[model samples]
Target chain A: MGELRRDPVRNRWVVIDPERPDREAALKVEAQPPPPLSGPCPLCPGNEAMTPPEIIAFGESSRQRNQTDWSVRVTPDLQPLCRIEGDFDRRPEGPFDVMNALGAHEIVIESPQHLLTWAEFPEQQLERVLRTYRMRSLDLRLDGRFRSLIVVKNNADAAGILRHPHSHVLALPFIPYGIEEELRGCREFYARKERCAFCDIILHERVSRVRRVVETDFFVVLAPFASRFPFETWLLPLRHASDFGKIGEKELVDLASLVKRTMQMVGKVLGNPSCTIVLHSTPFDEPHTHDYHWHLEIIPKTAPVAAFGWGARLFVNPIPPEEAAALMAQQM
Target chain B: MGELRRDPVRNRWVVIDPERPDREAALKVEAQPPPPLSGPCPLCPGNEAMTPPEIIAFGESSRQRNQTDWSVRVTPDLQPLCRIEGDFDRRPEGPFDVMNALGAHEIVIESPQHLLTWAEFPEQQLERVLRTYRMRSLDLRLDGRFRSLIVVKNNADAAGILRHPHSHVLALPFIPYGIEEELRGCREFYARKERCAFCDIILHERVSRVRRVVETDFFVVLAPFASRFPFETWLLPLRHASDFGKIGEKELVDLASLVKRTMQMVGKVLGNPSCTIVLHSTPFDEPHTHDYHWHLEIIPKTAPVAAFGWGARLFVNPIPPEEAAALMAQQM
Candidate 1:
């Protein structure tokens, strides 16, 4: 007789089953050994010849297009979600919305080794990764076809997936509605207050120090007051920056350190947890988005969003963000 | 390397985890042995004595404070996400937005039996279940505090942690932003054409006879052209009705038959697959939503959404709705 229920926050619905059993049994039965690596692993340095021609790479001193002595590599996705072809379709059939998949999707191999995690990369290597992301984003924006460029990292094991470490970058032709709403919300607040909403948030968190997860010279990681998910945290730059791809060279080192340190802290706190990290940037096609500040969101896989959360679009946040931040602060 | 990507249409992100070893798993696990019924199953008939007094019920029902003999029951949630208490404290404390949790959350016991699915119930019993939903919704709207009422059902193994079947109902004080966006989008379309958007969609599907998953006297289920997820289908009425709770008795019987028959069709087509079913109704607090028709969304758990899909709020639908409907039509 376990009944279904709806949460109002996100207007999503979930069915509440009254007979929940222990969840650990499934994990126990599925902890099989890792699959053997056969053939060429494109991420491995020696396998460079096996992948699409490198788009960008980092060598001993400066940027390198293609050289064996590389520390990091970036290449076009083998199976891209969006191809670099097609005449940006703008036709609409009655009420149905239609658009062309005009964008660039690329993959960044963080390390030459198959086993090294993105966080395990040295500071220099991490800085190189950031450089590649920025360079790619800048180049894509020049096409005027892409509205925005997004950078994301998918770490398995924490996100209920296989254990692997890599990140991705995508340039899109349209600014998503959700992100647009966020930008609008921020812009409205800024217009009224004469200051950046996120900057104000950072200042408040600095003073309260209640929800600060980790702090670096360039950035501070904290949990949002109204987190949509449990253990949801964010990394915001201390300085007010509209675009992630435009960070100063000096700030790049600090950003890299902050990112690496945060990932390590996450590994320590969640035990090498599987998680998703996303870098939200300004829509390139929309130059008037100065009100939107770029940031990164990291969601740990400690609690999977159930039907109640998904169906209703309402978050049943068991662990409040403030409390979660306190836990992370202690570990950091 | 696994990377995150965003889908264009639904504006959601998906993660392609290069690290995950399990690319494809079981679509839906078989139901495990029912949990021992000793823990006071919150949804059982006697459980009425455990939850808040019933709001509505059928079948030899007794109005006594904690009596049983009920086939379907509705009760206040033991632990509600939004409480029906105190004024909504809406204030901006500097940059942070805070509000008191205000609303009503309740559960719908679909069946008196612990193991029986709503689909397995007889046509009359299913009608009774739907009647309970509509009656309770109408009654809840009488309370001026609620802005909207949502009814949701999660069935099968893919959508549940507990093996038992159940549904949920919520009376929200706030008109959710997501639903508001849809209304705004539809209203804008209506303003231009002076016609209901959903009605036009219905006519299109009716004429094309493609993407129609199931049709009934009062209800027609179809896969939307711009589906957010794979196998994401909608159960809409043939008539242009805006309010589901306002449905008459005759329509209720037809809707019940439609829902039950549709679930059976789904089971037959997908091998008794699990799915989430959500009902959308008109807002009680906001008027002029009469132009918006109420419908139910049934999304089968086919694939895991990646970071690009979840993070960027984009979606990548691999299966076209028309194709999916054709598959289901064959099974039916």
Candidate 2:
């Protein structure tokens, strides 16, 4: 089991998972050329036995759990950073605070084929994948120990050796610092103007139109005015919603389309650079927060984050949001 | 010129420096092997004309500025992200805050001999480099527009094309979020215990000794309890100090040795991996804070910062600090 340790000075928690795969070993594996697409991928349909028992699967009714017919499958991570069976066991160690790593880590396998990414999946298959994300999020929230859940995809080379099309759904015991900061900002904004900050952003972007990349019927993809990375974008619903789990079936279909289209555009623009797509929603334990707005942040890893960024929480993005938006819009 | 933009949701500022060299161009330069030690290195002794005029130099008093006899030199960055001569035209665009990027960016050339690193420098030369850092920091603080100063070094391959043995001294108009978080946490800790959090950490580490890598007469280097990266170490003075610029001459010499020793140990253990070393001190504008203690954080870039870290502000460090400390100590 791993443990969560707090930095006394910064008061930030980090998961120290000794059980996680060795970094050097992972790097060595990544250094080799990726296996062939039709190679024995564990996430492929016939290799269901290579993975742990499926927690949930979406496919034909005649097929059994972890069967070939499944289009999407959710399973516990083989080497989870946080285990589901531990008590938090929070305690003090001198000046520092620590606790048992008590949460859930699951993988949402998006395709039955050896496809490399979700963007390459068909519309119907991608819709099932998005629906699976919502279903798993709602299911994980039922666990009282979990306070927050994040759906994140580490696609292509950036994800290391795990090349199959999948996203990770992490149930954390506490709201992460990033989300907490956003929530606090949103609450403050709401207290002052009685409006969600994200909602205000949507309205402002709609009027400005300079940073808007694409506007769909239900979602809008835009380059954030203060994007930390070049070509960084956000996908948000036009209608305000706080929890991803509460998204309607119709909204899920729209979200799937928007996500796929946005990713395709990103790939086209950046020559298929490795990226991280993360869904930010209200914490599972805090469903009643009206100020919070759910959204997806797509960050293309085009450059290395150097000292200036790592040391000072300050980023130097060469590309302006307006220019990035224009370039992305041109791709369409 | 660059502009600073603030993220409305997370309330973090980023410098959008369009004038800075493109990352791809820099990557191309870095892809080539490092220039030979005797090559026409701009930072080397005879090639002083190749770089900007020297702001300060430490060598034979008979030598003229930008001449060959300097052991240590300070010069303005050829391409600075922030310019020194500008008013911070702070304004609001909708809900977002924007300001002119106004600051001083200088490079502290560690040696005239094209030796690639400070670790290989003699103690006396390294001491001069440390003193130069203090002198430049004190000089920059005299400007009232500057609020914070960060002395950072990006060593080895991952730091980018600038392979010369040097450190960056940036004087910023705003205190970065990373420092602000530490200050806030420190203030909160002092409010409750009426003691500096860093002081408590030193005392605790002294007693525990599990995460202590090296302890000297004036400084102690230890792996942080919640280190975000593997083999991350922090060097702090034994006594509480709020400013790096205020270090005594003897303490500067001691810091120089400790820093070199720690870096050497890190290299021996990690096989000369790329790394970043950053100094965190009190903000220049408000210098009377008792809670904030100055320290140097050395982060060895052992692995890629993947999506989970970027999205959640949560880190999954595979190596625990205790284990990392032990490994580093063995190398020493």
Candidate 3:
């Protein structure tokens, strides 16, 4: 089993899972000319055997488990970050904290066809992908050990593990520092102003219009005021909500449309830049802080920033959110 | 003037400076095949006029200021992350915090020869580079606008802006969340153990010897137990200290040698991987936390992990630190 180790100097944990797939092997695909984009992939319909058996799938035609006809499929990651079967035993090893790397990591294969990304997906297929995300998020919460889940998609341009279009459904056994700090930021703002910080942001961006890329009935896609990367964006729900699993069907439909359209708009501007899109929500076991709002952060990966970011935690973004928003909005 | 904005959802700040080379223009050099190493480099001694005028330099036989005989040089970054000419004004903008992107940023040119990396530098040259780092750090503190200073070097392999071996001296107007958390982690551990957390880590690792890469009278080069990346290393001073600007002359020389040797050993194993090396210390104007120890975090930038990390704050390192330590240890 892989181990979860706590950082000695910071409130952080890393999943050290050499057995899952060594970094060398995990990234070996990149060494070769990517085998052509729409070629045989492990997540493709016929290659069901390559990945773990399907946990769920969404399509109008009812297909049996592990069938080829499904539009979107969910399967256990072949190289999971943390294994599902383990005792979440945490103990102190001298001065460091160590634990069993226990969690559920599943891949939500978005489309059977590798050619279509979120930007190119049919509206119905995009809705199904979003619906499947929520379904798996709720399903993973049933696991007693997990506390938080993030639905994450690293674009093909980002050199993700697979060329196939998919998002990872990672149910972590503990809340991450990012989640903790976000919650604290919200609670602190609410304690002072008696209002949700995200809600206030929606209000401010709506008035300013400079950072607002698209404002729909249910969702507003805005470039964050303090964007860490060029063309970074956020999909925020106008209606106050902390849990993604609790989103209404009508709202989900609007969110799906807005998300697809926003990505397309951003694509037109950046020529389809690689992006890491993470949908963050409240932890499963904790009592929900009303001020905490679910959000999707779309960070476009510009080259060499990561190397710079590692050394200095202070982010230095070149393109201001206002400029990024204006550039993206012009695509509309 | 550039602007600094606080993240709406996290206790984080970003310096958004479009004027200091927008991301597109900042990366234009990458679009073309890089100029041949040691070919018309700006940081070269003869090209002193190409960069901001020399702030300092070191060599046994010193030439006049901005002359061509220096082993190492210091100059203001032609495109600094934050400018030194701004008033550090901070205010809340609705729900978000806004501030002037005010600070001093300088480049520590480690070698005049572009082809000479730290692993290839002469022993004396390496010592001069380290000495230059300490000198610039103490000099930057004379400014009243900055609260924290980080002496950081991103290796040439890391796709740093300049091919010349250089370190960035970034003095921030506020203590970063990373510095804050590190101080807190040390304080909490001290509250219980009444011993410095880093000291205990040193004691524990020395007893184990598995993660120790090298140890000298003044310092220990270690692969941290919870390394966020493969072969992530740290250089810690054995003697108790919480500030990098306060290191003595002999200790600095010893640190330089150990740093050089450790990198060479790591180079032999990883085939010269790109790395971001950051020297973290106590924040200026803050009382030193007794349990906090100054250290250097050397993160080797493995490809594509940054993409995955952007989505999942919980790091998944395929290589365990123990195995990583053993790999580097074998090279020695």
Instruction: Write down the TM-score of every candidate.
Output: 0.87, 0.88, 0.87
Off by over 4 Å in 2: A1-39, B1-39
Candidate 2's residue-wise lDDT over B196-247, tens digit each? 8888888998899999999988899998776666677999999999999999
**Model 1 Cα displacement at B15 (Å)?**
13
Candidate 3: segments with Cα more than 4 A from true spot: A1-39, A60-62, B1-39, B59-62
Docking quality of model 2: it rates as incorrect
lDDT of each: 0.67, 0.74, 0.71
Summarize candidate 2's per-residue lDDT along A1-332 as a digit string, tens digits. Answer: 22222221122322222232221221111222455554567887888998889999988889887678887899997656567885667667786766667678799988876645656778888898888888888888998988899887876754355787888888887777777767776787777878888888899998999999999888899987776666779999999999989899888888888888887787777767777888899997777367988999898777554357775675565666777788788878
DockQ by candidate, in order: 0.26, 0.19, 0.17
Top TM-score hit: 2
Q: Residue B193 error for model 2, in Å?
A: 2.2
Prediction 3 global C-alpha lDDT: 0.71
TM-score of 2: 0.88
What is the DockQ score of candidate 3, to 2 decimals? 0.17
